[model samples]
Target chain A: MIDEKGILFILSGPSGVGKGTVRKALFEQDTNLKYSISMTTRTKREGGEQEGVDYFYRSHEQFEQMIHEKKMLEYAKYVGNYYGTPRQYVDEMIEKGHDVFLEIEVQGALQVKENFPQGVFIFLIPPSLEELKNRIVERGTETEDLIINRLKEARNEIEMMDKYDYVVVNDNIEDAVRKVQSIVQSEHCKRSRVAKQYKALLEVDDK
Target chain B: MIDEKGILFILSGPSGVGKGTVRKALFEQDTNLKYSISMTTRTKREGGEQEGVDYFYRSHEQFEQMIHEKKMLEYAKYVGNYYGTPRQYVDEMIEKGHDVFLEIEVQGALQVKENFPQGVFIFLIPPSLEELKNRIVERGTETEDLIINRLKEARNEIEMMDKYDYVVVNDNIEDAVRKVQSIVQSEHCKRSRVAKQYKALLEVDDK
Candidate 1:
C-alpha cells in the first residue's frame, strides 16, 4: 500500500432497507468508488450472471479450500451455501488507492471489522420498520413465511445498529446517496487518514 | 435541550489557512448552520462591524466578569485582549436543534473540546506550509514582520493538528465546503445521535 492507504467502507443493513438501490444510485453518482465483488458457493442462475461480475462463483470444494486457507475476509452459510467477501481482492484494491465498498450482512460486516478494524462501518436503515415491511411485501419475491422471518430478522438487525460508526436512513434515494457520499468525503479528511499527507507536505522546504 | 441534541462543530486551523473563506462559502451553501459569534474584549473596528453581528464587543471588565462566572465556552488572551465563545449562545442554538460551528484558534479550540467534548473538531489547513506563507503574503494586510510571525505561528499550530478529529485541506474553496457539509450531515447519522430516533420509531407498532 502507498503511504496514503485507501478506506474500506463496510456497508451493512437489514433486508428490504433499499440498501442495494441506494448503493447502485451511489455508484451511478460517484464512479470513483470500487465495490468488492463477493465470493459465493450458490449456484449461479442460468440467464445473466457473469463470473467476477455478479460474483466470484466458487464451487463448494473451492470455497471450503479458501476458508481453510483463511483467504476469506468474512464468510457465512445461508440456505446450505457459502457466501463471503474475499480478502485478497479487498487488499489489492485498497493498496491501489481505491476506496473499496463491501456490502455484506451484519454478521459478515462484524467479522470483517475484527480483521480490518480501520474500516468505516455504516449501518443503513429504513425510515421505519413499517416502511421496511411494506417494501418486502411489495417486492412479493418471497413467501409470507419468508417475509415474516425477514421482518423478525430486521428487528434483530436494528438492535445491533449501535455497533456501527454511522447510520444512513434510506428514506429518499438521492438524499441517502448524497449522505453516504458526504460521509466518504469527510472521512477522507479525518486526521488519522490524512496525517501522512500533512507530513509529506511539511517536508517540502519553504524557499 | 431536546432528547436529540444538535451537533457542535469546533473548527480551527492556523492563520492564512483560508478557514474564514471556506466557512463563509460553507454558510452560503448550507444556510441551516449557525455561526457561534464570539465575544471579544477588543474594540470592534469602526467602519463596518455591528454589535452582535461581527462580535459582542465587551469591555475588559464585562469580559472578565463573564470569565469569573464561568460563562465562556472557551477563552484566551491574544495581544492583551480576551476572546471567547459564549457558552449560553452555543447551548441555546444546540437546544433549538441547530448545528453550531465554532471557529476559534488552537488554544481556544482545545479548551472548548474539554467542556463540549461531544463537538466534532475539524482542523482546516493549507496543502503546504509554503502555500500558507504565500497566502499570508498575498493578503498584503500585514507587514513583513507580521507575516513572518504568522508563518511561525502556523507551523506551531499545525503541530497540534493530530488532536483534532478531521482535517480539511483548503486547496480549493468549493471542495473544502463540501467536505465540511458532508461532515455535518454524516455526524447527524451517527448512532449516538440517532439512537433516540430509532427508539421512537420502534415504539410505533407495526399493524
Candidate 2:
C-alpha cells in the first residue's frame, strides 16, 4: 500500500557514470516522477537554458536569503557556485503524490539524507575505473588535466558508496535504467509507508 | 555491483492472497530466482507431487531426527504435519549467487527474519477484504465456516504486515509481480554489499 506522501530519492554518482542520461531516460518513461531542480548562484552557460527549468538561477544575495530563511533543504559551495535544493517545491510535489528525485553530489546527498532521514539514497558506479576514464575521455568536454582530476574524484566518490542505500553499476545504460526503476518501485513498497496505509484501512470502521 | 552472495527474500501472505500464483508468474519471468522448497513430514497429496521439488516429504521420525540435529532453519506444525526449511540448500543457493525466495506463513517468515536480520521480508495483500473473501470462496474446497475461519486468519495475518520489510498489494497480478521483482533486484544494490565490492575492486594491498 503506497501513501499519498511521496518517497524522496537521492541519486549520486561520479561525473562519467551517466547519471544525467539515465535520469533523462527515466523521466521520459516515468511521468509520475518529479525532478527537484536545485537553485544555483552560477551563471547558466550557453545553449539557452531556462531560468526555472534548467536551474533556478539566483543571485548570491538571494541564495543567502534562502539559507537564512531556512528554505534550502541542503546546500553546498561547489567550484565558485552555490547550489542548493529548495524545500518548498519538493514538499509541494511530494504532497501532490509525485516522487521527488534529487540529483546531487555525494556531499550534498549526505546533507539531504541527514535532513530527510527517510530519503532513499542510491549511488551509481561505473563497471570499472578504466571504463569510467574511457567514458570521460570520450565526452571531449574536459582537458587532460580535468579528466585526471575527474578520475581522482571518482575514486573518492566510490569510497563513499557505503553511505548510500543502493548502488547501480552503470555497465549498460538500459540495464542501469532498469535497475534504478526497480529500486524506486521497490522503495514505494517499504513497510513503514505500507503499514500506515494498512492501518488506516483497518480503521475504516465499517459500521 | 551485486556480489556472488545473493540475498534471501521471505514472502508471506494469506492463502487466498495469490502468493503461489504470483510466485509462479515471477519464476516464469525471472529464472535466476530459486524458490526454497520446505521439508515436510506430511504425506504428499494425491496430485503426484514429486519429492525434493514440491517438498522433501520425509517420515516423522526422520524429520524429528533432523530437528534434533539442528539442520532445519525454521519449522512449524500445520494440521498434524511438520514443515520446515532446510538450511543447507538455502545457504548453498544464496552462496552460489541465486537469490532465494521462501514462501511461508507470517510466523515462519518472522522466525527467518529473526535469524537472518538482513533478509528481505515482503508481504502480499489482496486489494480488499471483499476481494480476498471472493478469491477464497472461489476455491470451492472449503465450507462457509471454513471460509470464515480463513478470513479470520487473514485478519490476523494483516496485523503483522508491519513486521515485513515491504508490503505489496496484489490488486493486479502483473503490477504485484513487477513490484516484487523490483524489490529483489534493488535489494542486491544495497550499500553494504556494494561498498564491500567496491573495496575489493580497489586492489590496494592491505597488509
Best by DockQ: 1
Calculate the i-RMS of every candidate, to one decimal place.
1.6, 2.7
Candidate 1 whole-model C-alpha lDDT, 0 to 1: 0.86
TM-score of chain A of each: 0.90, 0.88
Error of model 2, residue B26, in angstroms: 1.0
Model 1, A26-75: lDDT tens digits are 88888778999989999889999998998999999999999999899899
Q: Per-residue lDDT tens digits of candidate 2, residues B1-207?
A: 435587899888887999888988999998888999899998889978999899999999999998899788789888999999988888998889888998887788888877677788999988777788899999889999999999888888888887889999899989999999999888877777667866566434221
Provide chain B TM-scores across all predictions: 0.88, 0.89
List, for all models, the DockQ compared with the true complex: 0.69, 0.58
Taking every candidate in turn, the Cα RMSD to the unseen true structure, in Å, is 2.5, 2.6
Model 1 segments more than 4 A misplaced = A1-3, A42-48, B1-3, B42-49, B78-81
Q: Kindly give the stretch of ten consecutive residues in candidate 1 chain A with the minimal lDDT sum.
A: A198-207
Clashing pairs in 1: none
Candidate 2 wrongly placed segments (more than 4 Å): A1-3, A42-49, A76-81, A203-207, B43-48, B203-207
For each candidate, give its TM-score against the true structure: 0.92, 0.92
lDDT of 1 at B116: 86
The models' CA-based lDDT, in order, is 0.86, 0.85
